[model samples]
Target: MTSHQLTAGICSRLNEPEHSDELLSSTPIVQILSVKRVGSTNGPNPIDRYRIIVSDGEHFLQSMLATQLNHFVDDGKINKNTICRLDKFTCNMVQEKRLLIVLAVTVLEQSTTKIGSPVGLQNPPGDAVASPATAQQTPAANALSTTSTAPAVSSSTTTTPAAVRGQGARSGRGPNIFPIEGLSPYQNNWTIRARVTNKSEIKTWSNQRGEGKLFNVTFMDESGEIRGTAFNMVADALYDKLEEGKVYFISKAKVNLAKKQFNNVANEYELGLEKNTEVEECRDSSNFPVVRYNFIDLAKLQDMAKDALCDVIAIVKEIGDATEFTSKFGKTSLKRELTVVDRSGFSVRLTLWAKNAEKFTHTDQPVVALKGVKVGDFGGRNLTMTSSSSLEVNPDIPESHALRGWFDAGGNSENFQSHTNAFSGGGAVAFNRAEMMSLEEVKVKELGGSDKTDYFSTKATVMHLKPENIAYPACPTQGCSKKVFDQHDGWRCEKCDRSFEKPEYRYASTTVTAGCASADPVSSRYMISMAVSDYSGQAWFQGFNDLGEVLFKRPANELVAIRDRDEAKFTKLVEDVTGQQFNFSCRAKQDTYNETTRTRYGVQKILPLDYAEEARHLMELLAAPWAQ
Candidate 1:
């Protein structure tokens, strides 16, 4: 850090001789380094803190400097010297070695820094003391220039104040700057120097209503990276002015809290440049912090959900679709998924979004730096990236090239990720597809067919099969699925209190069990058989009155006998439709007394006649085929 880096301010106080005498005698000397007026988060306070990296050439000056600095003020708007006590000093040790420097009141802690006024420095107590409070408001150096007209005096002629000079004013303090580099807690203004790493190509957007530009840039520092955006007018200039790898000073940027649900970037916050922000291209880059992360551990990623922001790096394994999507803000975006595996025997899925996604897909193979990717969970959980995120592909980084060759040359580190089901809070139970059937009690192979070729086992139902090709008259009442009329010679309904010869359509189910010994998913075929026939065919179905008399009476044991009558035909019919043999299954409702399915269809059938258009639409979807 150079002294020129420190700014000079307007200090028109030394003009007063009395004020000058008090300043030079009471306060210790100082040399300012850097000054910044920062806004405070608490209350409405602002601070004008100076990074006064100080050193004392004389042993006596050390205690005096401490006493003065402890009383320094940081009220952003207060331009007066508020150096009250030198005891409240703070320092910290930095890993890098740096020269210990000292800071004095350079007058830069005020509005701006420019060496324009030598006369202003000559004046002591620019603003005369209205009362005793002004006594402490003046810087001691102002005394030298305060009495320009008085008899010129040097330190040899001056007498020290009543307080001891070098007897250690602060308690337990050590050999100050020798043991440290900077202050601890390192509190400073949001000062950053970043490079415009890949500025977005300038593009204009205009519509019938409005037009604007959405320009973006990636930012990198020693700590890691983040992204920033300029919308509309602001974007125009930045898009043209900002160049890649060029450092720039940034301030007054609006911080963006990342949308964790959408982005896969690791930063807690993204940022957008506000209209009032100050952005200047800096000539120096050495002072900028280089962004980096040690990559704590990869195994922890297994527990993270998709769309989580994280910093991860590993060699590429496979890439997926480079499909495009529209963002919620109406901007166009693209995405692609990749499988990234590391030495931890874990392969995490990475979803790259937008331009990065496109770039990754186009690259043949690149060892990448996925610094701020967000983890997400779509159909499957994985990592994603947002605009605030940054990516480096095949950069000249050691971790990148090394990981690439390490995984490529016979590394068992390429092991696929383990699923949550594989290892639970309990433990892992190793089993393959072959052993799954036995464990699940399922039959895999099917029975052979006629011509003795081969056969398949399905589980379908014997729905609507009559006792011996049966017949029955249905009830005439509306909205009733129950079979009301049951007669040997004539017709009568005991429930509806009506004599009936005509019948209404009702839900009549098939009676058959369907399942494989293992999984019982699709074997039965259920009401789908009836639905397919009634849905596409011209045949009207029998009402529930007929179903109750024929199929529902016998238990499943008795119904199996019919399978033997024409085993080939039965086997072929089941095999043709489901491609599996029928098994044990019955289609029963939650309530038997309700005559449920029949009642449902009964009411549904009448709606079309009564409500016409609505009924027609309802009838279109609410049928057996739809039921299937």
Candidate 2:
């Protein structure tokens, strides 16, 4: 042994509560037995801390270097079998264990050279042995080793603030609540006292493997949060007992790695309730963290990519009737659409599925709070509920209350920007397919009279394709078709803030299609601007970009390139489509151009005419009351 060697026996004395403070003042000389960085379980932005095991020849104890003294370990001044003295320190109770907090340290023997092996008890402190690379293990860190059930305690026992304090002071009688971060599959004997932040609806599943029902609850403590799931019998047993925002002492449950896809909790492991699991409600939950939500504002939702998951709180501004639909697999499900608005002056659509859809009732514009909702893009910005998601109407959270108050105070009447991308035509198209309408009836009914755009489909014959001014040069950026200006060096798009060496091409054209056989000069030209006759009437229709490509049977860029080469070739191409019949889905609305308000028709979709379907539609129109 070296002359300055201080045996591990002197270090073990610091573990005693009585001698800890005394030794901190009179530095204890010990050898650094082990040093490693502690793995932080906290979400992002974890602090760097080092845990060290030190020995004084006769005994050794685990300790942590204070943040200020972390540099000693980080700088390589502390290593295995290195002699060190606690120049200044503080010993305090952390998680029921006397933890030595090194405030300052002095190296008696540099770590540049290694010494003989540890002098104290050859084993590390606590129940588990530590390797040089292993982090220091205090009782709280190793609490997972406690395999026995926690002491039996009645749920009805008093858990008031005062009673809780009394229990902690009672020494052995106090409850041993394991930190959530300390939980892992390797340890089965531990109890966690946590507050239920959210509980999902019970969902039943059937598959080739088997059939079962399950429900999940998200729980959190001061240290961390995790999700617990109960399946079949276990789910049935605990569904009614676990209430949101209530604390419970849960034990005898299986812990496993959590699924990364659907969960948002920071912990990597999840708990599974079994037949032997015990859950006793805790009356006093003041110490546990209340439901914490990382809410995404409505306006910020626009910036999120498709299929993102987030939590949202907003006021239900509009509710659409629940609709039932059959899937390709023959499974029937109900879905309801809700338009929710927040203080951000934007409104978004939220979809509820199955039971949540069937049970939802829109009354008094209640505020809705959703957790772990999946972001979806059908036409525009919308949210969809996932199996693990939970929804609460008129939740008592602060944001809910604030929205309710604002809505009652004239917020409801305020004009909010709608994020729904559905076309402006009211009932223009229901779901993904357009409503069928005849050109004569569309003219008589004034389908686009309302402020909103209307969508309708008609089968018509192309009278003539206007050959003049057919195509335009468009921005070259992907997904951007805005026309660009011809700069001296290159084409420039102010909207995209980009300059391209060459511009892409697209087409917009006016095609005259007739949907009326009788062809009343006025009514014939009414539905369409230019003339071509169908079974009902002649009308002018508009086609642009994607729609134009369908009519021309080629890409707009190719057509534009061919047109730029020879105008006669483009004119011939347009004339070739004359008298061709096709089905067209169109958007009709009134707009002012050149200070004159006129009804404008634009083609939204174009496809080859289905003769059988067109015949059926004509028969339906003939038997209508308007025809009579």
Q: Which candidate should be chosen as best, given TM-score against the real structure?
A: 2
The ten-residue window of minimal lDDT in model 2 covers 519-528
Error of 1 at 507 (Å): 44
Q: Which stretches of candidate 2 lie over 4 Å from their true place?
A: 1-126, 131-174, 261-264, 286-288, 326-333, 420-628
Per-residue CA lDDT of model 1 for 339-417, tens digit only, reads 7776666666777766667777544555677655655433334566655556777766677777777776865344576
lDDT of 2: 0.62
Local accuracy by lDDT, each model: 0.37, 0.62
**lDDT string, candidate 2, 1-628, tens digits:** 4557574456556654344223434767777777765533332112345567777655566666644455576677777777887765544334444445564578877554444444433232453343423333435435322211111111222223233333333433233345554456665556667778778878777889999999988876544567889999999999999998788778889987776565555455788899998887765565545544568788877545455567899988889999999977677889998999998898888999888899898767888888768776556677898665678888767778888898899999989886553223212222122246778877888867778666567767889766554655566454566667889978889999988776545323321112112211210001112344577887777655445556677755456556767889877887787878777667678888899887776765557866786686576567433565
Model 2 shows how many backbone clashes?
28
